[model samples]
Target: MQDKKLSELAATIADPARHDPGDAPISISAGLADWMLAQKLSLAFTSYQTGQLIVAGVGPDLRLSFNQQQYARATGLCYDRGRLIVASMFQIWRLENMLRPGHYANNAFDMALVPRTAHTVGYLDTHELSVDTAGQIIFVNSRYSCLATIDDVHSFRPVWQPKFISALAPEDRCHLNGLAMDGGRPRFVTLAGISDEKDGWRAIRQRGGAVIDVASDEVVVSGLTMPHSPRVHDGALWLLDSGRGQIVRVDPANGKQDDVAFCPGFLRGLAFHGNWAIVTVSLAREDKFRELAIQEGLEERGLAAKCGVLIIDTRTGNVDHSILLGGKFTEMFDVALLPGVRNPMTIGPATVDMIGAVTIGNPAP
Candidate 1:
């Protein structure tokens, strides 16, 4: 994460059919508008590189509407029960939708996520997070190489860690980056390496990536390249083999990874909307991602790497739509889906009346 001029950074992001994106260009693929309209859903994503929480949805005119909210290094997003859990630089913010079923904001949006609570946890380089069936937030504490939850009297409560990790130290020994929940429980996790020392993943980040079972601490699959985003979709385990620019399904029993789709950039965050798998893609960072298979794969197809989101049809491995970023933002961390929500917006910490807009509990008769 070295400092670079915008001009120099722009060289990495691809110019895929620019669409006058604010502070950048967004290339929307054909039929994406129609597909979004039919699905009745919206997207919420984050970019720690640019420190923003962005929401994208189809408008009534069949075009896309993007709303970006400011946050300090926003990394992970979790949308459940009409609430969004946003992980940022220093704290985890819990936001709730204020609009009711028939209500719309500004005569267009049906959902507005307003920050309701903030848990100060310092900076543990937290990555992906999710809420279980019982409404508890579980997140990957990458810097500490463990899974943790918010504490009432302390910074965080360590819940689990890789068995290979001898101690719960803030060493980032394995770059654990993803947590996948099954049946509302943390079932699988992704790590860049299996090292047990300080920042040890850097040495093997290229080929030592692995997915581990949360319950058994057994390695489900290994020998990957910067693997990330373990997700449970359609009763299957899917993840991003980032260095190879591929989305793959893992066979837990045989330790096999089956390629589901090949994206054009370094894939990171992944979420599914019905049958479509939505993934975040970014150009390879030289120091960390030099010589990755993704660069060659994209070059072979006459494609350049991009920083944005891709909507892929998992059934056929075809990209249904793409939203490429070209300005200050060069990487995205995570994304989440908002079912039955269109044109989602957000209220920031300084916004007037954002704190006043509250939903009270029902009164007993």
Candidate 2:
């Protein structure tokens, strides 16, 4: 109905462990090389239950009715020439039947095609997708401890292989998730239950979550609780701190962090349209944090909560709009606004293919 007054929300960092984890050097492992290669996992964006519709939080009264049968669970979303191109955690798919004009069909699955990778190399399940200068698509393969880009959509092959941060160590390993393109360069943040060093120095640095700039290869922000996906919005870097159920905006020039919004439940995905920021929210499950709680066992306890997308206006710091989906049947991985091309999607090869077009860039700004 209206934006939550900032005064009503207490801006307090209750968990000290989540504040900072000084520069504690981690040890390198002997098996970093092999560990990096063996990092793939079963990733589904989970868009279905009964009816084939993948529900999305678009506006206060508007919910995107998509054909789930046409896609897996999409984790990241972006636009390619007005058409909605979603990153289904494990693969990429185009929405054919659901992208229609004013058509709300509560239906279920459609056929999908897995893009063929280079040399028959298996597709290294990836999360987010960002376009590069020549239309090359940059993606994060959660399984493989590295970042890669494919020049063509039809031929899923990586043209560039950036050196991984783990490669620096005898055995380096890190969970590369939530990638954002900063100033046209690949910058990423990481999330790990363990350490990335190979020398058995599992420095437990994460109180909540952390992110990094891949190009600079530096950990710009740290001490967060389960911060998964991040984006640069309104000239500032914004991220979803899932553990705390809040959205944070950090200014790169001076490292000034501001709390823009919060979702008490499971808030993961984040995106922006004009001056408004959209976050995918889900109900929080305390059982998932059992091991971490026992390990650190901090005195100040954080509350476990529910899930939904919370939209906020950066200019006025007001939530002028929002879309609340029923938690029982609604679990969204990512959200994207389709521009020009109406639904009923299909993907083959972009005329100005994003996979190789170096001119294309990130959605952040």
Candidate 3:
């Protein structure tokens, strides 16, 4: 993608309504808070359609609490080492959790994330962020059709590219969108197609998707429909077959796929907490997936695409809880599990509250 086109796309999504809480009303399941508390996990997700990063958890009062911070076209999200990494349109942001264990804010918040760093990557169409064991931020550089990391003197440093891709360019040939880590290293990835020409993935959006083993440089599974978020948990390789609205687990050895759960909306973001898989669902945009096979599957099942997070039990393939969004926030991009946090809050650059917030390190300890 050209820089001019990227700038224009960014400008088009700059909506002020994303900063207003009232513009997006959320309706969560009755037992959602209890389910989160039982799992001892807090949820964080990015809504690119609304340009907001949302965090949700249960407060000490046993009620569901949520906080929203605006980031332009927020898409990929990663939480590790008490820091939250978010990928926006033109930059990757790192927000540090400022609260210590057992520390509380206003006697409620246990986690307070404040923006600490921002790396401007010049809109490489970043997606599916992860922190490797070496503390490097690895992300899918979709535009270049490669895996990349932050560079001090350049837009981004290419770490690995598919063998079929001959060169690093902004062609977006295959639409690579998901990355999975094994033993803290890049293990597998999912892409819409295996083409090496500009925008070639669009031709096979229905059944040309595949999952590639990064180490072997081989396509392990194929014939998927817009698969995203290849996650490995409990000795299983799981991914969201987005075009079919199904979560399928694949055997890395033989490339066997098993249907785990069927969701109502277009699935994207995926995270695992214990035996539950937290998946993000988005209402399909007419311009994007109007005639996709997933749309036909929804209609056949008499289901409507919804925008929310579905908590699915991997053991039984059942949706145990959900957090539904209405009004302006109709789509989401990624979800992360924030462990050891009861109630979380964040400060955005647009808010006055961020300016007044200050923290001092121990002096000359």
The best candidate by TM-score is 3
Q: Taking the tens digit of each residue's C-alpha lDDT, what string does model 3 give over 1-365?
A: 77798666756556566344465678888888887887788999988877889999888789999989888889999999889999998899999877766788878899999998899998788999899999999999999999999999899999888898988988999999999989999999999999999999999877899999999898888999999999999888999999988999987667788999889888999999888899999987865656677777777889888899999998898988999999877788999999878789999967898898788766895
Evaluate residue 71 in candidate 2 and report its C-alpha lDDT on the 0 to 100 scale. 35
lDDT per residue for candidate 2 within 216-277, as digits (tens), equals 65667787766667787667888876655567889988878887765545566676766767
For each candidate in turn, the TM-score is 0.90, 0.59, 0.96
Q: Best by lDDT, which number?
A: 3
What would the per-residue lDDT of candidate 1 be over residues 1-365, giving only the tens digit for each residue? 22353333343233312312357677778787777778988888987777778999877676899888766668888988899999987689999888877988888888888898999887788899998888889999998999999998888999899988999887889999999999999999999999999999989887899999999999888889999999878767889999899999876657667898988888889998778899999866664445677777877898877889999988899988888888766888898889888788888775576757667656889
lDDT of each: 0.84, 0.46, 0.89
Residue 185 lDDT in model 1?
94
The lDDT-based order of candidates, best leading, equals: 3, 1, 2
